[model samples]
Target: MDTVKQSLKEASIFTHSQERPFKCSDCGSNFKRAADLREHERIHTEERPFSCSHCTKTFRTSSNLRQHQRVHTGERPFTCSVCGKGFTQLSSLLKHKVTHTQERPFKCSDCGRGFKSSGELMSHKRFHTAEGLFTCSVCGKGFNRSSHLQTHQRVHRFKSSSNLRKHHRVHTKEKPFPCSVCGKGFTQLSSLLKHKSTHTQERAFQCTDCGTGFESSHELLIHQRVHTGERPFSCSHCTKRFKRLSTLRIHQRVHTGEKPFPCSVCGKGFTQSSSLLRHNVTHTKERPFKCSD
Candidate 1:
């Protein structure tokens, strides 16, 4: 295989030397091989010549076509040795292998945080840069991440003034609605009403399979997902799924390393607001929960 070795050696030399002899006439983007340049030029022309035999889908390159064919064949040739997880592409397998080792090759210069991939590190770096890639048209508040901006925009979608005020209590840490039975405070009147029902032993919502009773319809729905074994919320980054949307949203912070809830005293960040509340008690030495003997 002298021919194969010679081709590999030439490719190595070209990569190291950064010698791109072939240049595109349209964009002036350089490529080492004429075929690669031609394939790239198809982006400008919108030419997808390579058609899949199984389906009507087409790709610009034969390599992409072969990769697409694996979907129909269910051929996952690239398998992780550690986890035994299979991937259609070698690149995806390589990315998955990093998770097993817990090795983060990419590091953020600003916060000194590490990430498994360059894409994750780039997303993390944007937090320090103050670049507003996503902006709210209503309040004009800028957010670096699109997800954070989308979450912020939900505040503006409140139909009633009372609903908007109830939501604002979360940020202000004000609980005006107090339960008459247990004297427990809640941000929203609906939550306070739900708490009052629990004291009265009101089983308004009952499960079909299980005899478990919930005070609210939302609690019943969440409980039903347990028996059904259905995870409706899934992480966009990975294959990890969750029963609740709130849990999935919190899990996404693990990938993004986004700690929105921070302790005021220690400045320690947490994925959940409840975790931050728990941590805040340590600073005040407040034991809110007690057992009566």
Candidate 2:
């Protein structure tokens, strides 16, 4: 009877009781448990107590650190029963499960649109409100979102007609600017300038682990990942992780069956541009690789 009473008391405390004894001094947020208050206080203090063994990244909670470690291990414990899809986090799996359901619990009052979650409905409500309205002065174009206006404003950034004509190369896929070192074509002069640095053999950023030099800090950070064994980018569809986000994006194409690269000669699609280039050699009867033995 005493055990049953204790269980009932605990259940009531979680479900019905509003009394929270533990309070955060920084945020004034109340919690039923001291551990909860400690976690909440970290947000205000900007304290990251838990550190990852594999990398320099740190987290406020041990659970977050454990999740971060999965990036290196490429572990996806959460699996969907319907499609057999894997996700790194349980919350992501839960979000994926909503796609299989036809039921929309939240309905928008403004447009009568149905959404699976309350967060979606709230985002939809923003379109009906003037809360995020933005306008462009150059073209007098209106956008419901500020981000759309910012992207549209880029067209107006180039004041001169010659600069605007140069920017049009991005849409036309024109590469007038060629690198003097490798003869590699680039659409912009700025890209050609950056490409020339690769041939200079002047790598300013040096890695402490292997004494490897990189042209830029970004390149150095990516090279450091080799020594750290850190693969930060994880595929949403599978347990595979990648050191680079671009590699992860390419890996996702396997799951999505998206072949963006197409052979102009054969109209055949390839998941990667390199694959298309290799297939093009078949038409030319060029055997680049041969067995020496």
Q: Provide C-alpha RMSD values for all models, in order.
A: 7.8, 11.3
Tens-digit per-residue lDDT, 202-258, candidate 1: 989999998899889999999999999999998899778899988888888787767
Give one digit per residue, the lDDT tens place, for model 2 in 1-293. 99999999987877677888898886678898888888888898899999998988889999999998998999999999999998889988887788788767678897776776554555456578764445788778776544466678889799899889888898998999998878999987877876778898788789998888877778899888898999999988867899998888778766644566756775445668899999899789789899999
lDDT of each: 0.84, 0.80
Question: What value of lDDT does candidate 1 attain over all alpha carbons?
Answer: 0.84
List the pairs of residues colliding in candidate 1. Answer: none
Lowest lDDT sum, 10 consecutive residues, model 1, at 262-271
Top of the candidates by TM-score: 1
